[model samples]
Target: MIYAFLNQKGGVGKTTLSIHTAAELSGRGRRVLLIDADPQGSSLAWSNYREKANFTVVGMPKATIHKEIDLLAQDYDDVVIDGPPRVTELARSIILSADIVVIPVQPSPMDVWAAAETVDLVREAQVYKPEIKCCLVINRKITNTAIGRDVRDALAELEVPVLKNDIGQRVAFAESAASGSTVLNQKLSKAAREIIKFVNELRRLK
Candidate 1:
């Protein structure tokens, strides 16, 4: 299975979510390959900082990745693509190359509005590959806030399903990233639990 984490707007936590999801899958003993499809190369940088990782991370920041992913994905059980931000053509290629496109939206009026373009691209890609599945996962959510609670309804207007399991605004995610590690490496902490629940719900999508 191939999963692409994408959002046209930056700072939506696409890279964080993609890397943690890849690490979680690897922790489960599955062969995982994380493709840094963003020209920013955030995922590749994370891999470089890490001393050791169970999974492999590679760079493919190109609009033509859809043409090359298959050969590179052959030996892996799962491939996770950390997509580029503010690049429509690259996003389209990532969407076409993925079996599932997971769009991470931050809870806010602007974030909700910004998602329309990404949703449109997903819909367009669906026209070409109807089997492709796409959904929104509310990230960096501030718990107990009205916006966080109402984001699902806001995203409803875009015609994309938002996942029930949402990741909250937590410092653990940043700390882990800075150290080239994942929350899962911290054991069953709050952050790790959130990611676990999120990924479990994701696995049920198909």
Candidate 2:
């Protein structure tokens, strides 16, 4: 299966979620491949920094990714795509190529509004590929904040499903990224448990 982490706005934790999800899947013994579809190549750099990454990571920052991904999918059990922020042709192609699209939205008005274009793109893709599963996950949510609860209510206005698990604003995420490691690789922590639960929820969607 192919899963793409996408959002029209930046700093929504798409790359962080993609890296952790890929690493967790690899730990489960799945042959995983992470494709960095963003021109920024953040995932590629993360892979480069890791001396012993379990899954394969590559950069494929082209608009024709939908055409190329199928051939690459045959070699791996799962593919995780970290998509670009803008709703360009490249983002559309990445959405079309994935079996599932996970859109990470920060719990704020600006981020929620920015996600509109991405939600529209997913809806448009669904018209052609109705089987494509798209979900909105709350990322970087501050604990005990009214804004977090309000964001969920606001997101209900969208025509997509919202994931039950919301990733908290944790320092561990930043630390993991800096070290080129996943939360799962760190000492047992809430961040690691949340990521594991998130991955399990994603699998249940399949």
Candidate 3:
């Protein structure tokens, strides 16, 4: 299976979610390949910092990635793409190549507002690949905030399926990223549990 984590807006935690997803999938014993489709190479840098041997990490930030991923993906059981931000051509290519597109939105007014374009792109992709599955996930949500509480209501206007499992605004995620590790390293932590539940929900979509 191929899963792409994307959003037009930056700092919404797309790379963090994608990295954790790859790590969780690797923990499940699947031969995972994390494709860094973002021109910024955030995932690549994360992989370089950690140097973990659990999965393969490759950089393929081209717009023609839909054409190239097939060959490279053949060797892996699952491919997780960390897509680029604000590049429509590349975003379209990633959407076309993925079996599932997970859009991570933070519980912020700006992030909620920015999701429309990404949703529109997904709609366009579905016109071509009718079987492609997509869903929105709340990421970096601040608990007890009014905007956070109302984010779902705001996102509802976009008419996309919002996953029940969400990732909170936690320092653990940033700490893990800085060290090339993931919340999975601390299984008992809330951050790890949230990611586990999120990934499990994704599996059911298959």
TM-score of each: 0.98, 0.97, 0.97
By TM-score, the best candidate is: 1
* lDDT per residue as tens, model 3, 33-81: 9999998999999998995679999999999988987898999999999
What's the residue-level lDDT of 166 in candidate 3?
85
Q: RMSD (Cα, Å) of candidate 1?
A: 0.8
| Candidate 2 residue 106 C-alpha distance from true site, Å | 0.5
- Candidate 2 lDDT, tens digit per residue, 89-206? 9888998999999999999999889888798898898899998899999999899999999999999999788999889899998987887777887647989988988899999999
Q: Which regions of candidate 3 deviate over 4 angstroms? A: none
Preferred candidate (lDDT higher): 2 or 3: 3
lDDT of 2 at 10: 90
Q: What is the lDDT of residue 45 in candidate 3?
A: 95
